[model samples]
Target: MGTRGLVAAMALMLCFGVDRVVSDASDHRYKAGDPVPLYANKVGPFHNPSETYRYYDLPFCSPEHVKEKSEALGEVLNGDRLVDAPYKLDFRVDIDSKLVCKKKLTKEDVSQFRTAVTKDYYFQMYYDDLPIWGFIGKVDREGKTDPSEFKYFLFKHINFDVLYNNDRVIEINAYTDPNALVDITEDQDIEVEFFYSVKWKETTTPFEKRMEKYSQTSSLPHHLEIHWFSIINSCVTVLLLTGFLATILMRVLKNDFVKYTHDEESAEDQEETGWKYIHGDVFRFPTNKSLFAACIGSGTQLFALTVFIFILALVGVFYPYNRGALFTALVVIYALTSGIAGYVATNFYCQLEGTNWVRNLLLTGCLFCGPLFLNFCFLNTVAIVYSSTAALPFGTILVILLIWTLVTSPLLVLGGIAGKNSNVEFQAPCRTTKYPREIPPLPWYRGTIPQMAMAGFLPFSAIYIELYYIFASVWGHKIYTIYSILFIVFIILLIVTAFITIALTYFQLAAEDHQWWWRALLCGGSTGLFIYGYCWYYYYARSDMSGFMQTSFFFGYMACICYGFFLMLGTVGFRAALFFVRHIYRSIKCE
Candidate 1:
């Protein structure tokens, strides 16, 4: 009852927590003539999401009193810092050309603008709860063949086209006029007037579908493209692998089972061969059982988290690449599922005859989060040094720490206590012998390393195509909104991993290798190494990313992600091998 109640509570929180969040500044719909707040978000090279600075970091006009919109947890975590803009836009109001400000540019100001233009920097703004994006300046080539003839011009005139349904905003678009371009190719002092115009139009689109326009914008990274060929190819590969497993592995195991059952009376006279010989040692607990159990528990929790978020995404709770929305859900869901980790780790550790429950509990909590903290801290330091908006503020760090200390700690304790009280015993089909058996040496091909390398390739090959799209969405300006395809690929990855691990474990046991516990787990996780290798390839061959800021952010977070994949896939493989060993050993006649 207690566990059920807690799960129910967490589910409710996950469902309702989104509604309670307020990313937009407006609390209520405004009437006509009421000034709507326009907020400036961040400025960065359009190609790179991580290399962002505050909008005001550039030499833009600032208001007399700097005011900012109150942000939610999602907003803060997404690196969003929304401040009041200089533009005055009212709901459903048309305004002529109005001068925002006229300022004399210093040499330093011109240099800054020139640098921004060179990098193709763009700015983001929010008007009436709708996000708007525009490039700060444009680069022009006077002579296509000559690098010296290239020129940079800043966009001084701001034009906003806002579409609204009767009382609500449907969309907002920002545009630049060619006549208003200010030449800034050379360092020269010039007076510039920033002018803005707002035109409101009525749209037939309902308020509910306002976010649809974002998907239509070519300027935004909301393009939802599904590589049908790649997806189909992956599907075919996985199907073949599954067919092989079903026909060959299953048939081989079946023949062994029948032969052993029928020839039990002659077994004592014949010398022991194959996996049956090591039945007594197959279930021996691996070294450092507590840590291994914690990793499995963390992996289980991550698997659950993956499913939950993908379901939410599929059901349209939110779309992909909406950083604020997606990031918040991940954080909230991960913490809520911490209890599962504690329960699984504690239970598994207890079954291993581990006496120190407290140490096991702490290991369960720290297994994944500890390394993640170090990774985040290193990335944050880089962001700070570069003065990028990607850095987490002091307040946001406190919030995360508080969540771990107050929320995660208590729930983990509750789950651990429940797991301890359950008192489940480890059940082995064959009794472990008091004296250890000397195992026979194997050939190079049968070695643990060779098995892992071979076992991991099948799974990695099955999903390598989808892996490209995923990497593009994360490190590049691509939006991946194909949840159904993603779900299919995820299932394929897990299935291939399980079957491959099972096949490898069976081969090892047949070779009289009783030390299969860690080998099976690692065999499943080796896919991460391939994935990390792909990351490097994509960085060099696929993406246009450069510079220290973006480079550090990309590799740092990606390493952590690859580690997570290792643990998740490893857990799946380990569980499958364990099930296979128990079933085969339990069925065959053994002394």
Candidate 2:
């Protein structure tokens, strides 16, 4: 209870929870005298997930030769930096008190404790593969505090509460007693002792349900309400787009077709400036067809990936508490699904009479992976500089590379070969001209930028609210469990993107632009721009997240997400536009 002394122990609390993706590397079926180990992981300020450091870096009385336990791939990616601890614990056993170590605190040690307490750092550790977090210490400060009024206190002793069921370790909890606090106000070298106690309790709860309690009290809200407003907004978006497309197909396009087909108007008086009149150039395949095809292919693959993940998640393949289950699935599935991208891209390229099959295939393979690799390297460098847990080890990086090389590459090549040999061709109703007709000066709304903006707005509106929750889970240490609503929003986003893109394509063709291929893709993908804008806004609002490593991590992550959106939505829109253009031109007579 002294105001001037060296710190005995420091307790830290973490917002987000962690779980062993694989088991804790120990056989949980322990006999009566089995020794249970408590492994210490990284520590960081509770507010910043990317800002993390090794727990032993805090000058804790760790073992003389501290050794780190090997972690699974998923565990490392989730930022686990495990180090051996000196405390002794055993399964199905209890100890009243344990003296970890006694050491004389140097000036540097006292300063370290003061900084950690002021920053409100948290400690992470694993016992029986279950993660437990505690705040290192607490700071008592007066309102608008003067420097003289701030008092820093470190929790000297920690108590572990273990709940086991059916002889299997189930849940873990760590607590700091208020009476066991040491103040670190004095600047001189002081003596300190770090001690801990353990209590083992038998519980009836099943092993599978052990993580249930942590789920209820993480950074996210325990009680989830149905997001009715977002769902209703999505529904409205669907209706609005459906009505607009219906009107264009049933009314406007109908009138335009009827005029040139039936009315034998004079050449001077005929509407020479409409979609029906530009049939020859409408299907003329946009410039940079290979790049365009690559985008489409990549997007198709991403779409497939999304659906596959949703199905798997619905079947309960991914347990929420499994720290890296979702991530592992994403990497593996994305790699295995490379064939989808290769085949789709090859088909589109052949349809446009593309010559360089190899180049196209290469581009398709690099579509997402290229940018992702570059971004990862940049952020990883920053993480290494900060000695943060967010930095990936070389072994993990090699594993990812091997997955892509051994699995993803061969599948992609096989797919490309299949598509190339099939010899697909574009079946245009009207023959495209050797040269494109001159496009007349169009109104402002008919421009590509305007059309893309209009095309993206409806789809972006549908998912904007859902994105907030998703962002919170990724960056704000919140857990999102409403996959049903997420899938609904996803479906709605795709439909709206397609319909809106079709509408824009029709307008561009109506304005006599004739180049609908890339327009539709760009227009549909513009939703990514809107999402990226929201990313910027979120960064500004969360200004406490400063420093180079954390900033790069956030933006790099968001860039990949936005790029995927662009590909997925853009492909959806392009397909819809292609279908509309083919159907309309086939139905009408063009002389």
Best-performing candidate as measured by TM-score: 1
Q: What do the candidate models score in CA lDDT, each in turn?
A: 0.78, 0.75
The 10-residue segment of model 2 with minimum total lDDT is 2-11
Tens digit of lDDT per residue, candidate 1, span 221-310? Answer: 333334666678778977786787768988888988877776776656776778988888888899999889998888888888778878
Q: What is the C-alpha RMSD of each candidate to the true structure, in Å?
A: 5.0, 6.3
- Which residue runs of candidate 2 sit more than 4 Å off their true CA positions? 1-20, 24-27, 217-223, 237-249, 257-261, 264-273
lDDT of 2: 0.75
Displacement of residue 66 (Cα, Å) in model 1 is 1.3
| Tens digit of per-residue lDDT, candidate 2, span 390-454 | 77889988887887888889989998888888887878899888999998887887778888788
Estimated TM-score for each candidate: 0.93, 0.90
